[model samples]
Target: MQSVERTFELLELMADSGGEVALSDLAEQSGLPLPTIHRIIRTLVNNGYARQQPSRRYALGPRLIRLGETASRALGSWARPYLAELTEITGESANMAVLDGEQIVYVAQAPSPHSMRMFTEVGRRVDAHATAVGKAVLATMPADEVAQLLARTPMSPKTENTITTIESMHEELERIRARGYSIDDGEQEVGVRCFAVAVPGAPAGAAISISGPEARMTRISTDEVIPLMQRLASSLSAELSASA
Candidate 1:
């Protein structure tokens, strides 16, 4: 049991180091002795869960990618019912997305029943600067890390209302944290509005959002929509945590 726990701790530490780490660094980070670290790492390498890099540092192996992809897909499937309930309650499209590298990728969506509705295809990747789900996920991260990420990606204007400057984005993120939700005010698309909340206790950078025409999804509706989405996000988070 102790060995299994230590092995997972090593794996998580390696993942936090962007999928690779030196043996000395792993020992320093994990507070584990060199022999224990070496034994666990060797076991992981033998099982194809970790690999030795050309630089002699260890990295997460290719086999884990298939497992991760499968788990992500299963996560989407598990959240569909919650998204569908959100759509039914809000009369708008509901979506679940996770921050992947420099972008937010939609993993699941439930369409609005209206004849004219906003639709973002599943698996579509969008810049984190232009969408409600992106902002929701970003709001949960540390400010310095968020700044580093934004520095790498161009915050191009998708619409006139899109946040194009880091200063403005920081202010917006502050508001999101205070308000407990995020809004895309015609930022991603003209006349379309979106509201989102982070899924607390869910896996890394997860959020859920609802989108519809601005006319239908107005300020008056927000009082009802925000709490509903928050509740749904909480429920989804519990489900995810259980499955994990």
Candidate 2:
């Protein structure tokens, strides 16, 4: 196989194992020699395609987001137009995110004019238990994987409202899956609330959300947000599926 094919295969191998692989593990898994794997990994690392943690394990790095953004920008032009529409209609900050480990990384955002809403940069990451988009996407993963992630990361409360127990977070994900949405009831911050919908995609878990002052967001229940978000999620899913 060609070097590019090997590189792409390496990416897939790492991604499927949840983005953390040891050198020995990668060599074993990829059927490549250790020195060859080291060279490929070093090349991938230098090019921003992978990261080697202090423990000497490798994981998907910032390059994945670069690739995701490129795909999102190209595939989500229609979604962008609608995001502005949603913000206009709801008067809340609208955003999109995807799961990266146990965190939700915002990939796009359309904020409302409200002076006191959540402010998120394009690449901001937050604990899944503390935000709407995080819960929405986490609902789609296998129970064992979720357990493993939560096991490694303690449920530290971002605010008094954050879920601080694994059992509770699991329950929250269950609700997200069954109800087809998720809510952040002042979880990440003291006075902010958000509602999110899952946007199913391969190798990445994306979600769309609306967040703002709790007083205002609570004025509209999850029921009110569902139709618009479901519509958006459906469109996003279709876009990703077609691209795949």
Candidate 3:
């Protein structure tokens, strides 16, 4: 059990380091002894979970890609029913997205019944600073880390309402934290409004959202919509945790 935990710790630390690290750095970051780190890393290398790079740093092995892609597909598959239910209840498009590095990747979506509804296709990637689902999940991250992530992205405005500065993003995230949900307010698209809430206790940065035309997803309706999104997000969190 201890070895298993240590192995995961090393893997997580490697991931945080952008998929590669030196042995000494891993020891320092994980607070594990050099010998212990070496032993676990050796086993990982032997099994193709980690590899010694040409530069002598250890990198996450290519083999993990298959596992990650499979798990991502499974996660999307499991979350679709919940997204579909939310779409049915809210009469809007429902989406599930996860933070992948500095980008938010839409994984699953159920379209609204309205013919003129907003559509964010599955596998579409967008900057984290420009979307409600992005803000919802980023609001759950540490302030410094969020800043670092934003620094890496271009912060380009998708629409006039998109957040284009780190300071503004911080302010937006604070409001999202207080409200327990996020509003897009035509940020990602000129005429669309979006509402999102993080899936608590799921993966590091997972969120669910509903979107529609701004005229339909109005401020007056927000009072009702937010609660439904929050409740469904909570339900999803529980189901995901239980399945894990």
Candidate 4:
């Protein structure tokens, strides 16, 4: 059991290091002896769960892709009920997204009953800087980490309200932190609005959001929306943590 735990810890450490690392770096990061890491890495490599790069660093292997896709599907299945409840409460489309590298990937969604409601397809990827779910997930990360992530991605403007500068994004994140939620005021598309909150204690950086047409969304007070989203986010967080 301890060996199993250590092996997974090493894999997680490698993932945190952007999916590749040297043995020495893994040893230092995991506080495990070099020999133990080497042995575990050798086993993983033999099983095709990891590979040795030409640079001699270890990286997650192609074998993990199937597992990751399976896990993502499972996560979406688990989130659907919560998303449905959120949509039922808010009368808007509800979405669950996870941070995948520098992008936000929608894993699950419950569409609003309205004929003219927001709809983002499951598995769609979008820029983190232009979406409420992305900003909500980013707000939970360290400032330096967030900076690094943003630096790697182009902050292209999707709409006039999109935040196109790092400084402005930082300010927006600050406001999100202070308010405990993030908002997309037609930043991703004209005449659409979104409200999102990070799911605490999720195994990965994740957020849930509700979105709809701006005209109808404005009719609902933020005071009513934010608290409801927070409560649902907290419930989903607890469920995820327990399952993890």
The lDDT per prediction is: 0.89, 0.80, 0.88, 0.91
User: Which 10-residue span in candidate 2 carries the lowest summed lDDT?
Assistant: 71-80
In terms of lDDT, the poorest run of 10 residues in model 3 is: 219-228
Which scores greater on lDDT, model 1 or model 3?
A: 1
Q: Write the per-residue lDDT of candidate 3 for residues 1-244, one digit (tens) a residue.
A: 9999999999988877767889999988899999999999999999999999999999998788787667778879988998889888888999999987678888889999999998887889898898999999999999998987787678998988888999999999999999899988888889988889999987858999998888888843777877887888888888888898
User: TM-score for each prediction?
Assistant: 0.79, 0.79, 0.88, 0.87
Looking at model 4, the pairs that clash are none
Error (Å) of candidate 3 at residue 34 is: 2.6
The regions of model 2 sitting more than 4 angstroms off are 1-6, 12-20, 27-78
Q: Model 1 off-target regions past 4 Å?
A: 100-103, 144-168, 186-191, 213-220, 241-244
| Candidate order by decreasing lDDT | 4, 1, 3, 2
**Cα error of candidate 4 at position 186, Å:** 2.6
What is the lDDT, from 0 to 100, of the residue 49 in candidate 3? 95
State the lDDT of candidate 1 residue by residue for 118-182, as single tens digits.
Answer: 99998899999999999999999999878877887899999989999999999999999999999
Q: What is the lDDT of candidate 2?
A: 0.80
Give the alpha carbon lDDT tens digit for every residue of 30-116 in model 4: 889999999999999999999999999999988997887787788888889989998998899999999876788899999999999
